[model samples]
Target: MGVIKGIEHVGITVPSIEAAERFFQQAFGAKTLYALIEKGGKSQEGDEMYDKNGLEPGTRIIAMRMMRIADGANVELFEVEGGHGATADAPSHMGIHHFALYVDDLEEAAARFRDAGGTMREGPIELGGKEKGPGNRCWFGVAPWGMQVEFIHLPSPIALDDQASSGPRWLPG
Candidate 1:
């Protein structure tokens, strides 16, 4: 619909927003866009926010931040009390999976991630098949906060992309 532009941001609950901020800054050069939000009755504002935002009852948010990485989608990080997702998830779970970052140089981006304490599981090899076509490469990895991340380089449109997506696929030049 014309009302929807595109992905505004993605929100994730981390064990510590401070650590998450550092990791994103070091790895992807994410710039903080705003101040942190601390919940749990620090002010009546927090309570009002929780109810309006559909937060879990008694959810104690230590901090939440808004960050922008490059010109792509923004990221919203939440640090909650007693959260257990301080490590990357193994064996894969349901719901939203990895977020792939479109990179000009997969090796260089992966290197930055590695330097910032991320881990990969091989690949970056050329992708083959009708949909992926040739010259497209992908590298899968785990973020410092244990989220799955991918560095993908798609030089051109994949096969049947026009039929699959609602709009034109967004890619970096």
Candidate 2:
């Protein structure tokens, strides 16, 4: 059996914890649950444990704040000491540059993000161009760490439908 239940949290490195906190609060209705200004880094054992999932040592994650979302998942905001993230000039500069947050309303989410001092980079348009389903999605304010946060409002009927449909029609064998 898989040894995983669900995601505990996702660390997001940012420049300012307060700013990021405010943005998340407005954008996704996230509330701050805890905060810490850690020096150096986390414990070696802790690092090792998390490393299995993709954490590493020597990273200068200065400040961290945990926020509680409506779905019970925790969003950990990490503010790194040095500048670490994609730059506006180089959009393709890889690494964890963005994360999508599923929201109920697109316009409301975008408005809240702007009100909370976050900048919207692109449209609340239909994604999955020329695809099967109507993937209505939207992009939002850049994070302090220079990552883009997208607010995705997927189709409700498909999301809630319980009936399973056939995968793909048979092909000539």
Q: Which candidate's lDDT is highest?
A: 1
Q: Which digits, one per residue and each the tens of the lDDT, describe model 2 over residues 9-94?
A: 86665667677788788767898888765545562222443345333333345567889877746888766543343343211122
Off by over 4 Å in 2: 38-59, 82-95, 129-135, 156-173
Residue-level lDDT of model 1, residues 11-90, one tens digit each, is: 77666667788989999999999856755435222334444654443445566789999989998877655333323331
Colliding residue pairs in candidate 1: 88-146
RMSD of candidates 1 onward, in order: 4.9, 8.1
Candidate models: Cα lDDT each: 0.71, 0.60
- What TM-score does candidate 2 get on C-alpha atoms? 0.64
For model 1, the superposed segments whose C-alpha errors exceed 4 Å read 38-51, 82-96, 128-130, 161-165
TM-score each candidate: 0.79, 0.64
* Clashes by residue pair, model 2: none
Top candidate, metric TM-score: 1
> Which run of 10 residues does model 2 get worst, by summed lDDT?
86-95
